[model samples]
Target: MVDPMKQFWVTVAAVFVALLIFVALPVVFLTGAMVSAVTSPSASGPSGPVVIELDLRGGVTDQAPQNPFAMFSGSGLSVMGIVDVLDRAQDDDDVRALFVRLPEAGMSPAAADEIRQAISRFRRAGKPVIAHSQGMMQSGAVVSSYMVGAAADEFWLQGNAALQAAGLQTEEIFFARAFERYGVEPQFEQRYEFKNAVNPFLQSDYTAAHREATLGWMNSVYLSAVANAARDRDMDRTVLQQALEAGPAMGEAARERGLVDRLGQVEEAEQRALTRAGEGAETISFASYAARPDTRRHRGPVIAVIEAEGPIVTGTGGSASPFGDASTIYSDRTAEAIYDAIEDEDVKAIVFRVSSPGGSDVASEQILAAVRAAVAAGKPVVVSMGAYAASGGYWISSEASHIVAQPTTLTGSIGVFGGKFVLSEALARFGVDIRSLSVGGETANLFSPADEFSAADRAAFSGWMDQIYDGFIQRVSRGRELPIERVREIARGRVWTGTEALRLGLVDELGGFHEAVQRAKVLAEIDEDADVQLRRFPAQQGFWEQLGLAFGGGAEAARALITLGALANDPDVQAAVREVQTARARAEGSHVLADEPL
Candidate 1:
């Protein structure tokens, strides 16, 4: 009964309204949010006698995520962010004290060290830092948790809780025997005996060199942890070390042994902290405090902090999930960030924060090139190594103006190893067969899974590995000002704790991010006590840009979905995927990999 013209008009009106609601309005809102976030001065903190509550239940991140939403969420806990907050609060009279809850599971040793340094500085400013632990489990990073707790003015343990702040242990599973039984062969060549990254496939047990190298670093880390705790607790270093080695102790026993200062529940600890904070002092969660603007403002020389955390790879780096923390140090992205810092006139110095195991050789070279370029431009680049900076991690850091690492940080695996597993026989057992044909040189099918490496292939691959290894040692020698012979003496792919690395001239200083920043300031001729503006490299993206990437259509959307799914899988499965990817790289002729297997 309706007229056709009237119907057409109504349909057009509905379409236009839908567009306004779904597309046009969202675009406008995102644009507004981006502008506001970018331009607005940070909101000031509440005025009061404030006691900051730092909860370390979740592990700390190396750096804040690039996600624009994270800017508003205030969910990310990064080492530098926490340090900056604590440093700022040190001078704020309104901020009376810090009450910390140690993480249930262990965090990275380097991160714990950085936070501990901040707490120490805060206490030096005459503010109390109270730390409480519910329990220290025998698993995970209990040692790291205790390290942070030991820095506190008043360290407390829950009643009936066990103190498992004992030591560190790493478990390795060798697949050589299992592979043989399953009719699979792992053929690999390492640069030297100490380069044991591929040992799981090559030996059923640790070789003499492998065991020696592993124990050397592990013992150093353990000794350093004990010494640090002893100094903080005012106890004899030998006695503290002996007590921890005796075994786990109960709460009261821990207090008696001078391991912890008191035994109480978390609530009691919090109340005690508040009482010490002063009359009518209110508590503010660390995250909330971090979200608030810094009370003191300083316009000073700029220091760029460029963070690269995770595996180094070719091409671009991006968040594994738009809303998650996992990311990679893609060569192009990291190089661009370094270049950006170099180009910024206000950036007087560069602090390169690296936390990675290792990845592509080419990618590491790219990042290292950028570091060299920064020095060439007269900007000093000081590296602050996080938990582990081995293999490719060391590659990029080798040529820095200065390098700082926590005493427990693992570094200096200057060696190469690569090969592939011949899986034809294993596949036959499963009633599966893979066939392939190629027309080319003798080496055309060198990487075929159906065959193992021949003599010619092995020789060629070994020579390639030698080239990479030689290049790595040469870079280290030049940077460290050591003789090539000295470099070679220590270049057998052995991992060293930062404490030992300092003695060996592998790392310039044994400290954390705080020390690195201080060194950067010194190198740049800035006053020791002067405040510096820390400009983060690869600046966070705007809200509109992130929104577009999150919901964009086509191949990009599909790739994002796939990455999200993979990241959301079980941790074990993700680990398996990582191992498989490494093997695949080796099979694809990437025979010059510098990696460590901690």
Candidate 2:
């Protein structure tokens, strides 16, 4: 028989040892890893002859994350940042060549165009740019892939990969018939016929105006893609179009058609690039090269770059989710950034970078006021559009001294729409009763989803919409220096490509972010060749603070609450959930720029 006291002591010792092994060891290991990561050298550039590797798989963003923690957690590369890297490499003697890995799912047409332009410049320096692709498919990806590939001095494709450039199309879902079957009524109104954002809920099919506008932009985009591709690939426009129509070509078929330069795997392509770069050549990632600190010290005037990305919402913008998806721009946060730039003595000008399809009208107006305030403070404001800047996007941009956009950019959806649906009938089917008591005047029940708009309510809503529409036209007229009549002619919720917008006087120039920066320099009276430090707005949080915020339980809990609230109130989600209710609004509806599909 064993002694009870001895056995108890031995058991206690064993448990203590297990705890040290299971808990303490992991804690120590994690601490050591964190320390090493923090202390690691920040130099990302290679020392000798390097072939810069550009990966186009993830698609580009307009701005890099400002927070260091977010960046460390693998943030997507910004288009401007990649362009800057290429510019630097063009002058870098150590960089012998450029290698590109094409994406399977294509990037945005505007983004691909910018990258193509950068590559063209790089090639002008007598350096080879080689692109290798696995495959390109799906809607919109084919054109994007071809555009980028055409910029390369040598384009290669995997033997099994297919070139599926089938052209462009737009799709919209209509819910009117379904709503009627469920006894839900959709009531909506818009300033004009061209503002068909609400038509999906009000009509079973495209109205004549809707079809006309959609076809207009779709054709414009397709033609532009073909022209650019033909010019880059040195192929006849007609021949290229026919090949695209008869696509899904593979291997030698693609090579024979001059669509690709060679058929091979990625390794074979890399070997070719290395051969052109000469002996002792190695590859370095574009991301790593971009992360290196600038060797030149910039003491010149500062040009602040404030990015207003995503839908414009009312409060302070939410932080990026843990998954790294971007969040919407909040009016308060954007206004704060504008004010910060204006108040800074070092910042001589502001470049407002906008990439949005538009959102809350009130939120847009608030941001516009901030822009006016910045100008009032004697700061020259310039707007640089990426992919989109329409409706509320244009609303905030109209007052800028100058606006720049890519030819492929979509802009100018100047319109307003509003209305709600009557969901009482739909609910009655489920035996749900909803009742409301109102003590205010006639318009108090105007927004109630259970009731349809009365004549008085309709008149009031129409008059309100007219007032907003009139203000929109006046702003555009004054800003663009065009007559009110001309502004009205193009303002009825019509969408336009950036090229068309420039011709119509809706935009000041056709170009990208670099052009905007150059314009800002001229406005600030700085020389074209002079060095100007580009500063980002809404300054990033400190390293320690970000570290805590990223890992702390507090932030996670708060994010959960905010997400729940967003799910309840998000306009997109609300529109989807209560389709009938959204259709019945008298004249109050979310006005979105129609370029999202493109």
Write candidate 2's Cα lDDT for 546-580 as tens digits. Answer: 43243332343334433433443344643443443
Name the regions of candidate 2 deviating beyond 4 angstroms.
1-39, 42-46, 65-75, 318-324, 542-544, 547-598
Per-residue CA lDDT of model 1 for 1-598, tens digit only, reads 8566764555455334333433332232233332222333321334689899998886678776665456445446888788889988898888999999997666777787888889999999999999999888766456778888999999999989888867877768999889999999998878788888999888899999999998888787667777788899998999987777778889888888888999999999999988999998888877657656554534799999899888899986343455655657889989999999999999999999998888888899999999999999999999999888999999999999999998888899988888888999999999998776778776677778888787877878778889999999999998889999998998889888888899999999988888899999999999999988888887764444454354332234334434433332335543454466557658898863532211
lDDT score at residue 104, model 2, on the 0-100 scale: 75
Q: Cα RMSD (Å) per model?
A: 13.6, 15.1
Which 10 consecutive residues of model 2 have the lowest summed lDDT?
28-37
| Global local distance difference test of model 1 | 0.80
Task: List the global CA lDDT of all models.
Answer: 0.80, 0.77
Instruction: Please report, as a residue range, the 10-residue window in candidate 1 with the lowest summed lDDT.
Output: 34-43
Q: Assess every candidate by TM-score.
A: 0.83, 0.83
lDDT of 1 at 439: 88
